[model samples]
Target: MKKSSQPSLLNNSEQKAALPCDHIPIRPGNFVADRIFLAKGSMTTPERVRFVERICALYPEAQLVECPDTPHNRIDLREQDNLARHQKGKHTLVFGEHKSAVRFSAEEGNACPNYWHFSPYGFCFYGCKYCYLAGTPSYWHSPAVRIFLNLEEILERIERVANQANMPTAFYLGKLQDGLALDPLTGFSGVQVPFFAQHKFARQVILTKTGQVEQLLKLDHNQHTILSWSLNPPELSERFEENVPTIAERLEAMKQCAEHGYPVRAIIMPLIPVKGWEKIYGGFVERLLESVPIQRLTLGGICIYQNAKALMEMKLGKGNNISQSLDPRSKIGDGRIRYAQPLRLEMYGHIVRTARKLRPDLELALCLEETKAWKELGIEDRMGHCNCLL
Candidate 1:
């Protein structure tokens, strides 16, 4: 039979012109890079050249090194001269082509609706102790922040994949890095928010822990971009999350995005069970719902691979409650350690009940959890309502 000439169902949106590459703006502050390493092939495109020139203008003194391989090679180079020191803050900026810009989640039994994930940047500036990327191959090499200059090609890849798929799909930005952490420096939101806004079949959902929303507030997101924030209570934020935005700042950003007509969501994941967690977390949830009209709220607890667990232990010291709390006897679908089933249930249940009472209309879901957990939480019907999906 001949294939149908019709387009994909989700690909029915009108074609929109992309924002001019030269018009993109940057809000460079203390987050400027010390040096930049560019892949030789990236400079061939005009868009790539303009993006590089923009960065060069911001940090005139930073050295620019052209690598023989794509910038991905520079990030995968495990033997940086001063590896330990570079991971602190004195990091290098590497921009290159993203060869395979879109792919399905390789995670096993991740309850989230399977969709494509692509990042304009990788390995965030905010170094949370329990970062799951720590266990992945990239962390083994270098955790320095990376920004890709070939965004035009990346967006084209998304459009092509969405046109080919049968159902509606979303391109997630937070899986590989904190989506918006360095937005002030890259001004990526200005470009991406509008691209997705115009695309009919493809949608963009960004997740971040940073409060950098100055540029986002001015964008015409057109409801196609969903902005979500990773949050924790004040006590937990002060303890485990260092050098990241405070809860107040993140909540305020969420409020601004919601007010600007952007679909807003929150992921209260890696919900740690520190002492007095129930009362503390319950109160935190109450205040958050009161301050913002959140469209969705997802809950999750400690989920880590062995290597990531070791990295967290090394950074936080061996006796850290995060690793100690995991059930070591068995591994989950993706070979990651997590809190015992009962503990996770209690933690997820607490926040769910607390938020439900305050805002019965709010959508609640889980992250990277298994089928049994979803059934236990009685949210099996809402399985697809995750951070990565609409």
Candidate 2:
């Protein structure tokens, strides 16, 4: 369980009414769950009550389970064993209290430093085969998709932190899950974007690989929200990102957001070195630049956690390209396996060179790379301004 020490911004009078909970029409096939569960203590709060009412209205046929206790802990050993047996259940949703709603990380050696994120939802609806969450301790323990009901409290904490910073700080929304992947069901974007727009010191950065942006485009964002997309070549998307929107649809969504006066960015991450990758990536970048006015472009290659690497190898088969291409000399740091230093420089350098040549004014950065690697890519000066930051 995670706890935030930051004080709430709400007063007694302000807490009388619940925060906004507006329901929007979900894009078809955006989220389809067979089972829905609520934690026993979830209904004590008004936000949870409204969230439950919204979910019930959206999926009337889903079998709702009121869990006797929190799913993170088990009463006995036998129940824990049963959860281990059913790791692959499809279309399950759990609405619970996010005990650890806000997490602050100061990664000293990486590209994105001094970052904070909150989990309005856990895991993702879109099935990406190489997702790092699958190998994590939390996902291994309880792999079911979860949506938090304490969003109003979470945002209050974020505002307090941003006020303390006394600068134009960013509050990231897509670290633990796809930020907007389940928006069709949750309508979080509709509420969150407007809240950030009203704040004086904070901005919201929402990252997603999913192409659900109808709710976002309708909001009066006032350039306070940065709508970033995780993108890749068409061939890779079709092969790995099952149930996700196509590359064309994602590009169209980015274009639409840009047209709506929102600052847009793209992260071409987990850059797989497939056959003819250069030609594919080059063409994709060309098309992207021509289609949308991107504010920033961040590039990254595969950096998987050790447990996630083992799980991916198991799911993708031992003969998969991801496993076969991993450099044996690459040491594991922060419990993650990375490509060798030389290989990382080659990959990042290639993409950086290709992108800068096409658009010299493009803002480029790396994701989760060390200081030395940043210097090697000639982007060490632009360290803090990453995808999640301004």
Best by TM-score: 1
Query: Lowest-scoring 10 consecutive residues by lDDT in candidate 1?
Result: 1-10
Model 2 regions lying over 4 Å from their true place = 1-19, 25-28, 45-47, 71-90, 106-111
Off by over 4 Å in 1: 1-20, 23-32, 68-70, 75-90
TM-score of each model, in listed order: 0.90, 0.89
Clashes of each: 2, 1
Model 2 CA lDDT for position 172: 86
User: What would the per-residue lDDT of candidate 1 be over residues 1-390, giving only the tens digit for each residue?
Assistant: 322244433233543333245455564433656667776455767666776777667777777777746556444444444335335432567676666766787766556567789978877767678888756776556655677766766777787776666345689999988899878777777778877776666788889987768888888988999888999898898889767888888888899889999999999888998889999999999999999888999998887887778777777888888877889754676777888888998898888889989999999899988888889878898988788887
Model 2 lowest lDDT segment of ten: 73-82
TM-score for model 1? Answer: 0.90
Report the lDDT tens digits of candidate 2 across residue range 43-160: 7777668667766777788877777476522212122432232244336677776766777875653555878887878877776767777666777556667777677777777777
